[model samples]
Target: MKSMKYFLLVLLTLMGAHYVEARPVTLVTLGNSLTAGDGDDGIGGGYPTRLVSKLQTANPGSVLLQFGISGDTTTDLINKQLTPAVAALNAAPSANRKIALVWIGSNDFFGFYNYTITEAWCSGMGLEACENSEFGASADNASTILAALQATGAALYIALLDDQSKRPVITEPALRAATFPNISDEYAARMATHLSAYNSRVQAHADTYGAQTVDFFNTTIFEAPATLSDDGNHPSGAGYDAITDIWHNAVTGSSPSSSSIVPNSH
Candidate 1:
């Protein structure tokens, strides 16, 4: 009788351990079109979908709550998205592990070169001056976003934006002329400088707010034609596939694998 009781206790302990190991996760994704699946219109719905699928293998029944709007700037996220994101985090199961992923500032950077620089607020300034002022405002808003998300008690992961000016849409002359008739080589160069500066601000905020910074700045994935969509601005299906790998590697602290990772949909 004593031996049988000991065996039962050990079996119960092992079952409890298995349950904890497979505890569900609550993942919140926050950003703009890139997070919203702009370029790839396939059923996968971009990185968030693919990421959740990968996460489920380790943590069964993981849930994703995405808050992404196309053309949104840092200011837009602060003004509109934060409240609901917090609500979702709060509503998640008490036992679930919480995480938030933020990838923004692309629109903020693009708007500065395309429109903000020409606005009356920046009327008399040179390219560099206007760029600084515009990106400065964006950086401040981004910091606000990070702070709020950090306060939610979720593990935060923020992605650094690449220099949009170097994208093929702007680098290829014919495409540039078609997209922005008035844009010049000088404008593109100035944009790159300001974008790099803005990325530093983003990195500093991530550090201060206790978020991990996912390095998207140095990847040549965006520069490769095969990774770009027909519009040349967004990532193609293949590009998103590569993006999924990069993000998974960061989250799992594992090397990126080219082999199949997505689970069967059916």
Candidate 2:
């Protein structure tokens, strides 16, 4: 069967007087603020840019298209970015290799718990019930997106949620005690557990689709003061650089850099 396919290709080449050429790999990203590069200096100012810098050094003509939005949820990715990401993959030749990134779910949790979300919903659903529902929905959407892209024969690199309880948005111990004193560290701990479950969902989806899962659960940049920007939620330049290293290690299957050591996606 292999020989037959090669013979047909040769015959077609002779008839058309044309030669087959390889296409550079395309990297399409779909996620939230991290993928959109929200907390970075500007649009295209996040890890993707650093990733491009790394990829370009080897694959000069490689294409990088990021479809991240600052506050996108898993549903937002499905409703908004999924179609475009598939379109981008389809535009390339069938034989070309492709890579995509799907790092989301933080906002699903954040959106549910934000001050503007109102307590009525939580009181009705119960806090644990709400968390479980979000977790299930996030996993389902991630699976749908991964299956569609996998059908195009592209390699995918899905990321797990970072430990957001450490982010400034949730940390300020004193302020947290004053603001939501009833549930300060307790809330953070609950979020950490939920995110871990979400990461497991992402990993299961990746395994089902022959994709790679990138890790961010144990990264210290978010926990440390140096890597965070003034907003505290968004990563500083140094933080992005550290994230780039993490991504580089993930995509290339290398050991983590000096910035981090959390390796296994599982």
Candidate 3:
């Protein structure tokens, strides 16, 4: 009977371990106003909340935490958002899945544009040089955030910023230059080019860190009035659902694009 008693104790220990392993995952979203569900229906809980619900259907007990501060840039993410997310992810039980979804840089571009044009800040750097510098800094800051997220061993997905040029705020001449006063079409086009380059850098980072990319830059919801809010920037409730559908596809391994998941560079 001594042998039987020992076996029971071992089985009980194993069962306890299994119970811990069966706990829910945590999905952390790092983004800006849109990710916060700024313009969505009801009380402004948008895609992230819907995404949490969707994930719960598959990962029953899974929970979500959104750190999407409006006007947050890549620098803000590095200086403010990264530390807490990394800590939470690392502190969670090792068996639980730690996942992160990052989408930022909206204010970074605006900030860069304004800073570059300011006579005092620009001095004699020349507009092209100033823009390039801002672009590079944004990319570098984003890389830093991604590295921190990767360090926590979380499954990472970094979204490429959408084409602001398509947004109503940018297209309408009066509203377009609201942030970057007197911004010309030609100059805005250059900004879009810089944004594209930024996205390329984002994909490169994902390749380095075994993460994924969601190509909102190439996504079609921009001009679709139904997908965008009345203001033409943040997504509507239906837009959130559409965004979540795309995210769900990526999470389920059927990535929207063939190159969505970056291959790790050993």
- Candidate 1, residue 158: the lDDT equals 88
Best by TM-score: 1
Ranking of all predicted structures according to TM-score, beginning with the best and ending with the worst: 1, 3, 2
Candidate 1 wrong stretches, greater than 4 Å: 1-22, 256-266
Give the lDDT of residue 79 in candidate 3: 76
Best model per lDDT: 1
lDDT of 3 by residue, 1-266 (tens): 99985675577467542212223567888878877787787435777787767666555777887887887888877777788888878787755677888988877776665565766666578878877787788877777888888888888888888877677767776666564565678767877888899888888887888778887887867667888777766788878878887776665454433322212212
User: What shift in Å separates residue 64 of candidate 1 from its native position after superposition?
Assistant: 0.9
In model 3, residue pairs whose N, Cα or C atoms come closer than 3 Å (at least 3 residues apart or on different chains), thus clashing, are none
lDDT agreement with native, every candidate: 0.77, 0.72, 0.73
Better of 2 and 3 by lDDT: 3
Worst 10-residue lDDT window, candidate 3? 257-266
Any idea what lDDT model 3 has? 0.73
**Cα RMSDs, all models:** 6.6, 8.7, 8.1
Clashing pairs in 2: none
